[model samples]
Target chain A: MRIGVVTFPGSLDDVDAQRAVRVAGGDPVALWHGDHDLQGVDAVVLPGGFSYGDYLRCGAIARFAPVMSEVVDAAHHGLPVLGICNGFQILCESHLLPGALVRNDHQRFVCRDQRLRIEDATSAWTGSYAAGQEIVVPLKNGEGGYVADEATLDALEGEGHVVARYLGGNPNGSLRDIAGIRNAAGNVVGLMPHPEHAVEDLCGPGTDGLGFFTSALRALVG
Target chain B: MARVVVDVMLKPEILDPQGKAVHGALPRLGFGGISDVRQGKRFELEVEGEVTEERLAEVRQIAETLLSNPVIEDYAVRVEQ
Candidate 1:
């Protein structure tokens, strides 16, 4: 399987996402922000970083990147897409997912190993994990708080669209401790944590995050 | 040419930590009785054509789509003399 990782001007984790794809036994393709083409990859990953210097808003300007047009189209067509950290902010900004990520409620940047419980493991990017499984991944960001209207939050919960929930504590004060969520079609996922950082045990807290990449591969190949 | 100003702000229900921080600091700096401080964004757009109903509508669309996220924000647009 081939996974495409897009690099925006300020993307800091595209390389790490590519490495994670390779670790999961998939070919990693490099896609550029200015390009509208997806390079024919089976899936796409929007890596974390302060795109466009986090100006205007986090992920606000990056959502207008040329590549995002293609990503939005492909994602709606059932192409598996995962957005991590700032990437998640972009996804929400692009309207691929509901809600918005505002500044951390504590008004500070936070970085630490965050524990997340798998709420729904049936999505394209989470199929490898068992329901209720807890995994620790690096969570780092200033604008990581998730917020939406009560109706939207209720809908997301009622439909079981929440993919992961913070286990130990709400690091960024996200509503209901929502760490990650999947689209209604289950093709797109947006999460605040940095899964790519936890793909290897030597460089990270553990190898628990490899499952996200592997799960995408399985969904594409199957 | 006319300059169009767009002010975007988070909805009242959403939490504004920056605004809260500013509100807290005002009293410490000897500015009292300031009940609230809501931080927001301002966009100045230059339009080459005359400001008409059509132009204002277009600017409104831009404000809704790009200048502010409707999910958590509210925006108002106006032409500046």
Candidate 2:
């Protein structure tokens, strides 16, 4: 399968995302934020970073990038899209997903190997794991707190749209310890942790994150 | 040209860590009795022509869509004197 990784002006993990895609037995394509084209990739990953210098708001400005317009459109059309870290913020800002990420409640930037429970393994990007499986990946961010209105939160929980929940403890005080979530259609996912950074055992927590990329491939094949 | 100002603030229910930090520092600086501090952003836009009621409505639209995220924030727009 061919997966596209988009590079915004300040994206720091585009290369890592591409590497993870390659490690998962897929061809990786490079996409630019300023371009409107998706390059016809089977799937797309919005990598982590302080895109556009985290200006105005994290992922707020980057959400207006030309590529994001296409992404928003494609995502609505059931194209599989995974957003990591700032990418998660972009998804929320673009309204592809609900809620918003805010400043960490502790008022500090946190980096750690975070444990997460796969709450819903049925999404296009999470089909590799069984429901309730646990995995460890790197979580790093300043504004990673997830928040939304109570009704929306209830709906997300009631509808099984929550994809992952933080294990051990809430790293950024995200609401209900949510680490990641999927859209109602399950084609779009937004995650705070850096799974791409953990796909390699030599450099990260472990190879647990490989499932995310591999899952996309599996979904694409079937 | 007329200037329009938009002030954006986090929702009341949401926690404001930056504002909390500032609020915490105030006691050390001998400023007392301040119950809270909620940090927010203010944007000043220079409109090319007269600031009409229609223009203010447009600015309000911009404020809602771009200046602030409605999910987490609220914004108010007004013309500067």
Candidate 3:
């Protein structure tokens, strides 16, 4: 399977995401923000970063990037896309997912091994995990608080669209402790935590996040 | 050239940490009695042509689509003399 990792000008985790894809037995493709072509990859990963210097808002400028128009269209057509951190912000900005990520309620950058529970494991990016399973991954960001209206929140919860929920404690004051969420179709998922960072036991807290990449491979192959 | 200003603010329901931080430091610095503070962004756009009602509407569209995120923010647009 081939997975594409998009690198925006300020992307910080594109290489790591590609490595994770390779580690999961998938060929990794490097994609550019300035190019509109997707290179015909089966899956797309928007790595974490301060894209376009995070000007105006996090992921705001990148949302209008030449490549993003292609991503938005591909995502709607059932192309599996996983967005991490700033990638998640971009997905929300692109309207591929619901809600927004605001500045941390504490007004500071937070970097830690965050515990998350797999709330919905049936999504394209999370099928390798079992529902209700807990995993720890690196979570780092200044603007990571997730928020939405009551109706939308209730709908997300009621429809099983929430992919992950924070475990142990709410790190950034995200509503309902939502760490990640998937679109209604379950093909596009937006996660604040860095699953790519946790794919290796040597450099990461553990190999708890490898399932995300492997799940995409499985979704593509199976 | 005419200048159009757009003020973008987080919706009342959303928390503004930067704004709250400023609000927190006020009383400590003896600037008291202010109940709250909310920080927002102001964008000024320079139009090359005359500022017509149509242009103002276009600016409003820009404010709605680019200057602010409707999901979490509200924006006001006006032409400055």
Candidate 4:
């Protein structure tokens, strides 16, 4: 399968995301933020980084990039989109995903190997893993909080949209220890952790994140 | 001329360290009345005409692009004519 990774001006994790896609036995395409085209890729990734220097607000500027218009349209049609960190920020800004990410409650940037429970591996982006399976990946962000109203939160929980829950402890104080979530259709996912950085043993965390990439692959094949 | 006020706040998912720090310090300052505090921003813009849906949407796009982070914050727009 072919997967596209978008590169915004300040995207720091595009390379890692591409590497992970390759490691998952898929071809990776590099996409530019200013371009409104998806290059016909089956799946797309909004990689992590301080887009536009996190100016005005993190993920705020990049959410209006020309490319995201296409990403949003594609995502609505059941095209799989996975957003990591700042990428997740863009998704929320665009309203593709519900809720927002705020700064860490501790008033400092937090970085660590975060453990996450795969709450629903049946989603399009997480089909390879068993439900309730736990995996560890790197989490680094000054703004990684996830928030929504009580009613919305309950709906997400009831609809099986809360894709992952934080394990070990809440790294960024996300509501209810949520680490990731899927759209109602389960084709789109937004996660605060850097799974791409953990897909290899040569550096960073172990290959626990390989499941996410491989899971997307399975979704494509099936 | 019409005026619109936009209030942007971080969604509950994100941690507001700044808000928490202030909340933590308020008790030491002999003012323990504050229960919760979150820091966000507000925007005021003037528009040329009536606040149509299209105009509001354009402004929303501008706010999303220039004023707020959707990942961490939610924004509300209020207009007065």
What are the TM-scores, per candidate, against the unseen true structure? 0.98, 0.99, 0.99, 0.83
Error of 1 at A30 (Å): 0.3
User: lDDT by residue for model 3 over B1-81, one digit each (tens)?
Assistant: 999999999999999999999999998999988999999999989999899999999999998888899999999888889
Enumerate residue pairs that collide in model 1.
none
The DockQ scores of all candidates, in the order shown, are 0.85, 0.96, 0.95, 0.51
* Fraction of native Cα contacts reproduced by each candidate: 0.79, 0.95, 0.95, 0.89
TM-score of 4: 0.83
Candidate 1 — which residues are off by over 4 angstroms?
none
Q: How well is each residue in A12-52 modelled by candidate 2, as lDDT tens digits?
A: 99999999999999999999999999999999999999999
Measured with C-alpha atoms, the lDDT of residue A109 in candidate 3 is 96
Q: Roughly what TM-score does model 3 have, to 2 decimal places?
A: 0.99
Each model's interface RMSD (Å)?
Answer: 0.7, 0.4, 0.5, 3.3
Model 1 achieves a DockQ score of 0.85
* Model 4: residues with Cα > 4 Å off, grouped in runs: B1-16, B22-38, B42-81
Please give, for every candidate in the order listed, the TM-score of chain B alone compared with the true chain B.
Answer: 0.95, 0.95, 0.94, 0.81
* Candidate of highest DockQ: 2
Q: Which ten residues in a row have the lowest lDDT in candidate 3 chain B?
A: B58-67
Candidates' C-alpha lDDT: 0.94, 0.95, 0.95, 0.87
Reference contacts reproduced by model 2: 0.95
Query: By the DockQ metric, which is better: model 1 or model 3?
Result: 3
